[model samples]
Target: MVSSSSTPAAFVTGAANGIGEAVVARFLAGGYRVAMVDLDADRLRAAREKADPAGERTIEAVADVTDEQSVRAAISATVEAFGRLDAAHNNAGITSSGPNTHELELSAWQRTLDVDLTGVWLCMKHQLPVMLEQGSGAIVNTASIAGHIGYRNAAAYAAAKHGVVGLTKTAAIEYAPQGIRVNAVSPGPVQSDMLEASFERRGAAVRDWYYASSPTGRFASLEDIAHAVHWLASAEASFITGHCLSVDGGWIAQ
Candidate 1:
C-alpha cells in the first residue's frame, strides 16, 4: 500500500507541537504522508492546517496514548488513509513532579508513569502488529538524557524515561528479525513550552544551568532532535537499531 505512491507514510504521536511537530514537519517536507496524532483536537487541527492545509499528505488524529483503544483506532485510521504504515514515532509524553521527589505525590508518580512510560508501550502494542503484517517498519521512540542519568527532583519523569530506553532496546531486538527497526532519541533541554513550564513551576530561572551544562552553551534546537528521529527512521540509519541516540548538547558527556 505504501509503495503505491512514490512516497512513504508515517504515524506520529505527540505530533501537535514541540519535538513531535518538528518530526512531522520533517517527514512531510520529505514527501512522506503523516498521520499527526495528539490529545488536543484543536491543536491537531491547527497542526494539520499549518503543515498540510490542502489535506493532501497530512491528516490529524486525536487520541490519548494512555488509552489502548484510542491508540489502536488511531493507527487503524492511519492505515485506512495512507494505505499502509511504514514508520512510527511514539513521541507522546508528559513531565511533572518538579525536582523534589519527596514533595511528589503518589498520584503524580502514577500519572507520570501512566503517560510517559505506559503510553509508549500502548502505542507500540498496536503499531508493531501493523508493521509485522507489512513485514517492514521503523519506529523511533522519544527518550531523554534523564533516561541515562539520575536527574534530581524528577524521580517520576526520570524513571519513566529510563523505562522508555529499556523498552526501545528490548523491542528493537525482538522485532529486528521481522524486518523492523526500533530505536530511540534522547534529548537534552530544548526550548519548548513544556520545558519552559517546568522551570516556571519551580520558579527557577534555569537558562544559565542549561547553558552551563551544555558545552555547546545552548539548549538543543527542536530541529536537531527532529533530524535525529528522521535519520533513525529513514533508510539512512538502516544498520542502526536497538540504539538510544542522544540529541543532547553534550549534557550526558559531562
Candidate 2:
C-alpha cells in the first residue's frame, strides 16, 4: 500500500556515521522524513544537521539498539513524530576484534551477538508491530560478507551477521502477505572513516591485501551500500523480499 501522506518516512539505526550516515542522506535527498537512531548523541545530532540542515525532516533518537526498551522507545518516538512508518534500516552493529575462534573469550562472543544480531531483532520487533498495524512497510538489515562467507578472526561478528541474514529471510516470508518487504545488504570491505583508520593503524600492507581480496581491487564506498539499502526499502524492490543484496565489490564471488 502506498503511504497515506505524500511524504513517506524512514527510521534508520546507526545513523551517526559511515554507511548509516550515508543512508540517512540518501533518504533525505529522496524527500523522506527520517528518524536518525544511534547511541552517540553528539554524532547523531551532527549527522542530522548534515542531512537535514533546516531541521524539517529528521528526528534524532539517541538510543542503544542492544537495549530492548531503548529500541522500543526509539520506534515509538518515530511513529509518534511521523504518524506512520514506511521503512526501516536496522544498520547498527559492532565488529568483533577477536584474535581467533579458539582464543576468543566468551564475553567477547556474547557482546558481538548481543549488539549485531539481537539489536537488529529488537528493532524489527518494535518496527514490525507498527508496520503490521499499517499493513505496509519495508525493512532492510545490514548483513556482511562475513555473513555469507567467513571472516578469518572475527568469528563472533560473522556469526551475528549470519543470524541477521537468517532473521531477515524469516521475517520476509512471514510478513510479505501483509505488505511488508524484508531484505538485507551484505557489504564486503567498505571505504569509510573506520576502514581508513584501520589502514592508518595497520599500515599500507594491510590496505593492499584488502584491495587484492576484492575482484574489483577496491573497497565499496559508503554510498554504494547506502544506495542498495535505500533501493531495497523502496517500492522498486516490492517483489524482492528475503533477498540478501551484496554490495561487495565482487569479493565474495572469488
Q: Candidate 1: where is the Cα deviation over 4 Å?
A: 1-6
Q: All candidates' TM-scores? A: 0.96, 0.96
Per-residue lDDT of candidate 1, residues 119-214 (tens digit) = 999999999988888888999999999899998888999999999999999999999999999999999998898888877776555655766678
- Report the number of clashing residue pairs per model: 2, 0
User: lDDT, candidate 2, residue 116?
Assistant: 96
lDDT of 2: 0.91
- Candidate 2's displacement at residue 191, Å, is 0.5
Q: What RMSD does model 2 have?
A: 1.9
How accurate locally, in lDDT, is each candidate?
0.90, 0.91
TM-score for predicted model 1 compared with the true structure: 0.96
Q: What is the C-alpha RMSD of each candidate to the true structure, in Å?
A: 1.5, 1.9
lDDT of 2 by residue, 1-254 (tens): 32367588999999999999999999988889999999999999999898889999999999998899999999888888888899899999887753879999999999999999999999999999889988999999999989998788789999999999999999999999999999999998999987888778778987899987888878899999989999998888878999999999888888
